[model samples]
Every structure is written in structure tokens, then in C-alpha cells.
Target: MSTLARWLLALFGWKVIYVPPPAPKAVLIFYPHTSNWDFFIGILTRSVVRLPARYAAKDTLFRWPFGWIFAKLGGVPVNRRERTGLVNQLAEEFKRHESFYLVITPEGTRRATSSIKSGFYRLTMLAGVPLGCAFIDYSRREIGVLGYLNLTGNQAEDLTNIVKLYAGRRGKHPTQEGRLVFAAESARSGD
Candidate 1:
């Protein structure tokens, strides 16, 4: 099914707009992840771009016949409710792997939030890797990595730059005011 999706996307001329030279070993950040279609578009984007990216899904999604399919499509099962420290686990995974690229949705949900979660930032920092921005703009029919940046741990300033980069850019999903709100909060909190 994954291969079929890739082939179909290719036949339709769905291509990557831009990809960084010497793709860095890092986590890929996807924003406004709000629907199931985001998965299909993301897969198509990865296939078209030939990017080795993986995304986290719920543990329940890993069960049954679909389990193999999801695994083949680079879906990593995550128990969101568990008390385990996910950043630590991801950092360990990065440490063990020479080249790892994981896709994370900063929104963390299909519904809108007033603030974006800081997990992706923390994970990238802990793993000592850069962060690449990926997006699916339905209106433009493009799915690709826009750019990469080194996080300086100044959440406020860093997020300001990121938001500016992605602003006015349509995504496969919708963005709530949360990202902007969080950016402001981070500035105030000095996080």
C-alpha cells in the first residue's frame, strides 16, 4: 500500500519543491497536523522527496493487519498516556542510530490548541540534532521540507523566527492561534 501510494503520487507529478543539501540528521517538525489526510500527504511528500522520515502514532493504531502497513509506512507507536519520559527515549534512540529522522507534530492534536507543545524542541535539543520544517500546502499541491535550523534553546526567539518562516503558508491542517500564543508565553516565561 505504501509503495502504491508512492507510485500514484509520482504519476500525478507530486514532487518536492526544495530539499536541503546534505540532509541533516535531525527531527522533522510538522505543524497544524489536523486530519487523517495529513498522513497520506505526508507519506506522499516523503516518497516524492525520498526522505527517510518517521512519525509517531497511537499504540492502538499498531494493532491488527494494519500494524504491518503502518510500520512499513514509518509509523512509530507511542503510548501517549504513559508516564515514561518520551524525550529521553527519543534521545536514546537518536544516540543509538547514526542517522535518524523523526517527524513530529507540534500541535500534538487534530483540534486546535492555544499553545504549541515544546516536546519537539526538547527532543531535538536532547538528541543534539537540527530541526527541519516540513509542510503540506493543499492549495499549492506541494509537500516538502522548507528549511532547517539549529535551535538555540531560546524558545521565544527561536519560535518567533520559525513562525515567521511558516507564516501565511497554508498547511495540510489548520493552525490555531496557539502557536502564536505560545510564542508570546515563551517570551514572557524565558523558556
Candidate 2:
């Protein structure tokens, strides 16, 4: 574990309660990403679990000194505003790399929203990889990996089952709501 990650663990008193499947290729999904602290807890969880997971962030944040640090910490910068397709770009990245664990937030933001972006499902489908669930429960100061969800191109059914698995999990971020909220809403909207 990196020093920053160790410091975070000490500061937050985080503990991983679940161990995910040992998959070579997978997309890890995180919920209720409503604050910057979500990333902090995520870093600690990843380090404690000893997983070589990578996450995407806005391109602008990868500047100079900070960029160097992010790269060392396994950050993949994505151009969110680019007119080019995102799924294709991520698919290509996945194809280029022999093994990688990409982390994505289904909610896509910290604020309360009624729906989840389909990029996570689309990325896994295009890359032909499974989905892993990473969750943080602030109420319990617990962070866990909820195994893997093998995608079968049936977005509605697959997501429903996945969300049901994490039905009562709470969000670590303050502004964002619980995972159940987004999961239930996603199921209702069929997104």
C-alpha cells in the first residue's frame, strides 16, 4: 500500500468485509459517488484489498505533478466532452492492455439523481469482461468488494440482479444517496 493510501486507512478506520472473485479482467462498479471522499475511501479499500484497479477521471485533472501521481496510482484520464464515442475508446484501451481492472461509478456523479449512466454496462459488454461491485458503507465504516457479475448483454436483467445484491448498502459520500436509491431507480427506469 502507498503512503497516502495507508494514511487514509488510518484516518478513516476502513475495513474490507468481503472478497471478490479472482478475475483477471473485470469492470468494478462503485455507487453513490457523491463526494471527493468517495475516491479517498476507494483508494484505501483498493490498497487494503491489494487489487490493481484503475479508475477514469476527467482529462483536465491529469495535469503535471498531480498527473504524475495519478498515473503512478493507476488513473486513466478520459475526455468526457469529446465527440468521439467513449465506449469505443475504453474498449480499445481494454484490448490494448493484457490485464486491467477498471473502476466506474454507475451514478456518474455525487448529487442525487434518478438514473444511472449506461456506460458501465456498455463498457463491460464491449470489452467482454465481467462486472465487480465495490461498495462503501459510511454508517459502518466498511468497504467491500461484492464479487463479480457476468454480463450477458441483458442490461435490464443483469443490472436488476446486481442491484438487488446490494439493496441495502449506503453511500460513503455526504451529498449522494444510498446505493438502494440508484439501484431501485435504475431498475424502475429500465436504465
The model with the greatest lDDT is: 2
Candidate 1 regions with alpha-carbon error over 4 angstroms: 1-7, 10-15, 21-24, 172-191
Per-residue lDDT of model 1, residues 1-191, tens digit only: 55775678667666556566254478887765667877887887676566778897777888997898999888888777775788889889888887789998887766767677777899988888888888666656666778888889997788877887677656555553236446458567664
Count of residue pairs whose backbone atoms collide, per candidate = 1, 1
Error of 1 at 103 (Å): 0.5
Expressed as tens digits, the lDDT of each residue in 56-131 for candidate 2 is 8777779985888777878888776765588788888888988888998777667776677778888999898888
Which pairs in model 2 have colliding backbones? 34-110
* Stretches of model 2 off by over 4 angstroms after superposition: 2-11, 173-175, 178-191
Against the true structure, what is each candidate's TM-score? 0.84, 0.83
lDDT of 2 at 158: 86
In order, candidate lDDTs are 0.75, 0.76
